[model samples]
Target: MFTRILPAFAAGLLAASPVAADTDIAFALDWRFEGPSAPYFLAIDNGHFEAEGLSVEITAGQGSLDAIPKVASGAFPLGFADINSLVRFLDQNPGAPVTAVMMVYDSPPFSIVGRVSQGISGIGDLEGSVLGAPPPDGAWAQFPILAEVNGIDVSTITIEPVGFPTREPMLAEGNVDAVTGFNFSSYLSLARLGVPEEDITTILFADHGVELYGNAIIVNTDFAAENPEIVTGFLTAVARGWSDAIADPLAAAAAVIERNPAGDQELEGRRLELAIEANVLTDYVRENGMGQIDADRMDRAIEQLRLTYEFTSEPDAALYFTDAYLPDAELRMIAPE
Candidate 1:
């Protein structure tokens, strides 16, 4: 089961990290313009960033790991990406100069999405089936852990290496039994492709045996050092944006609609609502607020990673995340609706 942590570091979090000298921020996103990306747009439209004396430009990325090298190389000072992937990147590169500043997805949406018609309904049905997985997908990277904990032999499942554009299509067309992706992303995508809601089966990793965290706001260490205030302010704005988004998902999707003219408002709105319920509005976030991590759970996540990823060097939690830049608890607290 997914771990729901207590408030261990709330009141003592922020020590007033102010805006950096450079108010202009180049932020990168982990995926394209979708429902989950609404909060950031809300932050921009609502003037939260401007209120904090910061001007932010968010760029869409290819995948979870796509933003890592960009931030590490200083091509972007800030980015959103999978923290698990970040850990591996740090171990592989050693001193890459990028780390997560805010924990956004308390319970990740990683899942194996399938259709009942494909002779699949649960994780048990995976054997003797083809799983369409994008090589760069965050969920595919973590499939080994799910398989290990559940005692499902991965070798029995045929993995079809598919591109992101084709992953959901293959599953919807019955060309593959299932696909590994984020719960909201894949489920909604399949529905968009005319897959019946009754036929789609989403087995979330968090619901199974995985205790991993999800995508987070990452920053270049060099930029953070130079502009601690800017980083803090940016995170504060992000928290506010998410809070507002939770309160009014329809408005949040409206903000997204403005950016992507080709997107369907109704579909995007429903997508935002799904993400809010499944990924964002968690028990821990409701109780302890947002933008921080549970140290004990993080330790467990590292141990779980050891099941598949072999670290080149010892893992350090300090290098991966820091709540020092988070806003004060009062600002971060998300009231339950």
Candidate 2:
């Protein structure tokens, strides 16, 4: 169980009447409707958004970098995306009105998954082996940074650029020794392909050396400034949704299966559990609640990015994220499952 103290103002925000004009919010997700995405759907199914005077419509995204432009272009008022990608996007397209407001994956899922039977087990095992990577994969985009920090000589590895659909299949078929992907997604994909669970080895960049934050709730800065209350209300509802998901992952995945009828309930439930254990409910997040970042860790993450990415402008953490719209502390904490 978890406990929190809520200020009067914060309590008032959460208890705001649903009679207020419902602000239509189109939320763009970073990836397809998988286990991790169930919370947002759970929010809608449970009337959490409606209580906050919000009508949110969620759409699946192609990849980690998919939703940044959508939100910045004003096509979507809000989105979930890789914060690391957002930092680079803002640097390349200066003055683009997009920034992360709530951190979802406190510990990012960027990882290199391998098969033990294929003679690949960890970061160092990739040397002299074929590594399958998708051009737009969030994990692949961060591999250079991971290699630099971990002292893994990327040049020693043969990289085979593969499509998203082919990434897991090629690795499972032993065409590639390993693949860069989310730990939860890739692990489950291999399992469903009939690979023995003991043969799978997940080398999480975060565990080895990567000090980066993962997918975050991004917003159009211009829109957020204009509709501060709406943003706050949206976050409150989201926090509640995530809280529910953490408490009952099976139910959360069931909520997702309701939307995507083809999705396997058991597989998605396991996927959601892995994400919660490895990404979302970290030691820091469990203690401090969610939707905020530690300044020191964020500073280190920025410096780590600078190793591989030459920023056109000086990197400023302020331009990338803000907790201004996060709900109250009580609303943010997800009770231990």
Candidate 3:
């Protein structure tokens, strides 16, 4: 009932679409198995990929930038990663074979998680406080733009280059006043570390003035060119998987736990819910279906990136994302929260 549009409009057309011979796909993820990944696991379990004539193996990654080179190198045919990072990678590499086929998170999860008790109730409050940032972190990489747009004085802030493993724990222990991370990731991780939920202040970059996007599904250009039908089918299945997750996030989280047994189910479920409500299902995506980017917004994002990263070449939005493989609107629609 939460799904606003009836999907029957394109069902017949999608059924008539040419089916690719069963293909095996190796998918590289941006981070370790977590709540956000449940949709892909659900895709495998719910027969979405099988229905698309594809068998997929999703590999965990080290960080947001981890999948870019792997997918670009053709070590993996497809990957999920940050588009901002991808822009930088492509600008630097100049003829990389990888490009984003689908936009997964309409609004990015990049955020600054701080303790309210540490006087980090808002963006300006970040001044004169310790900010723990991981060098390779996608969120931390974009902190400068978030700072520039929000008018925060970076000089007053003490930045600590922390490791990913110690990021949230250091904040929970009050070792650092705040930490840069994904909204769903750091917020829930701190709660699990026994930090009071009310004391945690999540400053999502999207909610602020930052006009950037989040992670997306990317594919090797050569692979997509050689197997166009397979690429389309894979993207369709991925969209279906996300729709299924939006329908029942708790069940989706359990699907993730099936593969990552060491993970805490309840905490992951909460994390999944956080991701769904905050990042995945944005107002723009609610009306426009998933997996497609807004050109004007993407242009704004590129301009914002210029504030922090110096592009080696002029940025091209076409080189970054192509919606050629996205499923029809009906098929891409997810249930609104």
Candidate 4:
């Protein structure tokens, strides 16, 4: 399911070099500080970013799609966002200076999180149920494709457009039967809301027929074109941080707590572990390493998107992502323990 692709026009991919001076990098997170975001904090706490001669300030975002416009408008030089949303954004906006530079979630966390007590456990269970979905949720954006692939009739499902803050609470309060969200985020939220573990059911899109990549480290094409070394160095430090995080996710969560004092350390730690086990440390990542993606898989993802989206022009792989700024393969690999 993976094919190593060497892009002929990748400018900085061949050079394993360092940046000259400290560059101020403003990184925009796709969501609020949580378990999965620990690696970036670990990168900062462990001096990985500093070692790369970068002063990075991380900003929290509203949703997966929130970071797209921030990076495209040059508000943030780098960001974490859903590449599928980026595909749609590019189609609608035409010439946005943003593209995924590194693949973070090799397997997307998109899922329909439901409570078993609410008559939901599998994809088919969603029928005749009210599903709460945030309008901008990345998973909701892909619901059409999920439905098509699974043979679920979306018309039979009642979709209640909910806010991000209310998506889980609505389901937890029995306002809706299920919710579209990231598996880890919604599952943990329901648990925190006093929903029993046995009562929760997370039907991941990947487990079904969806072949989609998840959130990725996106960059402003303008910034990357001007400072390729800075981009490469930043990605190298990110790889180091993720490798360390995979080794000790509890430590990674502790790093996150250091930034957000209000965060529950135990909960975040569990969330981080879940993300590492379920999304980040997939067979592809374990065998091939991080950052770089499978070319064939990406093509399939594009085709999958084509099912729900109408591209303004021919979808060019180069315009969406590149391994140009990724670190060396060895540094990117997260060894299994």
Candidate 5:
């Protein structure tokens, strides 16, 4: 049966050759392997990365902001990071030489979840409200910039760091008017705890002019240039893995479970569901195919980062990303109807 052969086949492929030893690559994760990392697990489980002669060792990163320095210092050849963190890193490091290979979420998942009873419909309504935010260095630091673009005064908002444990309780117990978090992650958590859909209001940052990418595969520019074939092969395998994950998210989730047995099952399940919905619904994949990046969008993202964050100088396009290795044909492969 296919099921019986699949696991063995995957194992064989990973062990088949020492090519990975010769051209080994380390992929640093932005966080612990949970929902957002299912595709990488799927690729490894299905022998996709192995087929490309890539021995990818995936390690958990401290966080997005911290992950940048490690990648820039060549601690890892590849890393998964958000566009905001990447931009900030480039601002500080100047010529660090890193580039995005592909985008994961077409729309950044950052959002403010408000209790509907408070009548917080948009960013404009948040003025004078108690907003439970992550720390200054946390993901929520960008919310002020998002508010600024939408013509909302950032000073009118009161921000208090909710730390990590108090997000759901703060929102449910009326301790905070709104909380900053990833819609896919936090919304699902709330819904699972019986938060009514009508009571939940999500305002995505991308809708308000903070348009930026999220969870992209990044590489060292020098490594990509010197080992073009290796880069091409790795991307091709990743594309195949992405298509496979899209075709069967259940299988992808299972792959993730196989690797991280201690991970939250319900959270991983919800993550896969949301990822599939976001991936299929976006114009990023529908028009240009999966893993496609638009130059205009990239420019817009860069501009937003520069203007909003006040970069000392323009980041070199070459240092941020390259599409030379993106497999055009492979990216277009869709599941059979």
Candidate 6:
């Protein structure tokens, strides 16, 4: 029972006299267009953004950290960012103001994969072993806290910045004992390369002390404040898009392929399959509905950031998001109708 709404501007124009015109929004992605970002592609391909009265111009971001400053300065009104980096930004730049409109992945998928034959049971055994990780500028900053929670000394582990495509081969060839990568893609790629599942050990961040949320839809605080209605409309449409994606993942993947013709169909399929398995909404927003944020989880994440990173001060929860924009009907979508 999917119902489509007309573009927000059209609905508004029809309801009222000819006044000021439509509003435009620019959305920045944390990486080049790919599968994990299918919902956004679906929204665009299916006219969801247009229906919400938004003319969205999507752009690829340098990375999560790079996206934040651009968003804060209004280089882009809205952007996708890693939740951990968002927390750090809030702590450092209190007045800059940003809010997460919706969460993309409820669980962090970053994991350390090691060969089982190496006797790496978990994070504890990684000590004294060479570990390949992305640069500290990326998600590597959180690895220390992950190690701490696992009773491993942060200093005892050597973190070499192994470039993205080289991580798998480096580990396989014994250049590094283990490597950090997305469990979803890396595991499947390893399997495709003939690495047996039984021979691999994965230490997921969610299973450790890194309990922060992952990819999130965020906007500049001023933009959210100045154009609350636009924000609400965008969020409402995004909610519908996520629901549509979850209800029919295969359709969603096809929609993604249609939008990004250059994308790899096999990789996108695998990515979507993994996303479904992760059940991104469970244990967090499932009860409240898609795109809902839990204040408690946010609070815990803030505390963890403070304790682990020695953040100078705590950030106020209200600054990060508002529930006012979420449509009531969309919030009920996760329930049995």
| TM-scores for every predicted model | 0.93, 0.93, 0.93, 0.93, 0.84, 0.84
Instruction: List where candidate 5 sits over 4 angstroms from the true fold.
Output: 1-23, 136-141, 264-266, 279-281, 332-337
Clashes of each: 4, 0, 0, 0, 5, 2
lDDT of 1 by residue, 260-311 (tens): 8888877888888888898877888888888889999999999999999889
Candidate 6's residue-wise lDDT over 53-149, tens digit each?
A: 6766667655556678767866666778777787778878877867677776677666788877766667778988888886733446667667766
How well is each residue in 210-301 modelled by candidate 5, as lDDT tens digits? 86776677776666666666766777777677677777666577777767887666667667777667533376566566566677877877
Model 5 lowest lDDT segment of ten = 1-10
- How far does residue 95 in candidate 1 sit from its true spot (Å)? 0.8
lDDT of 2: 0.87
TM-score of 2: 0.93
User: Stretches of candidate 3 above 4 Å error?
Assistant: 1-21
TM-score winner between 2 and 5, please give it: 2
Each candidate: what lDDT?
0.87, 0.87, 0.87, 0.86, 0.68, 0.68
Candidate 2 segments whose C-alpha is farther than 4 A from its true place? 1-19
Alpha carbon RMSD to native, model 6: 5.9
**Model 4 shows how many backbone clashes?**
0
Question: Which has the higher lDDT value, candidate number 2 or candidate number 6?
Answer: 2
Candidate 4 to truth, TM: 0.93
Compared with the true structure, the alpha-carbon lDDT of candidate 4 equals 0.86
Better candidate number, 4 or 6, judged by TM-score: 4
Find the candidate with the highest lDDT and give its number: 2
Query: In model 4, what lDDT does residue 121 have?
Result: 81
Q: List the candidate 4 regions with Cα displacement exceeding 4 Å.
A: 1-18
How far residue 209's Cα lies from its native spot in candidate 6, in Å, is 4.3
lDDT of 4 by residue, 91-122 (tens): 88888889999998999999999999999988
Any runs in candidate 1 off by more than 4 Å, and if so which? 1-22
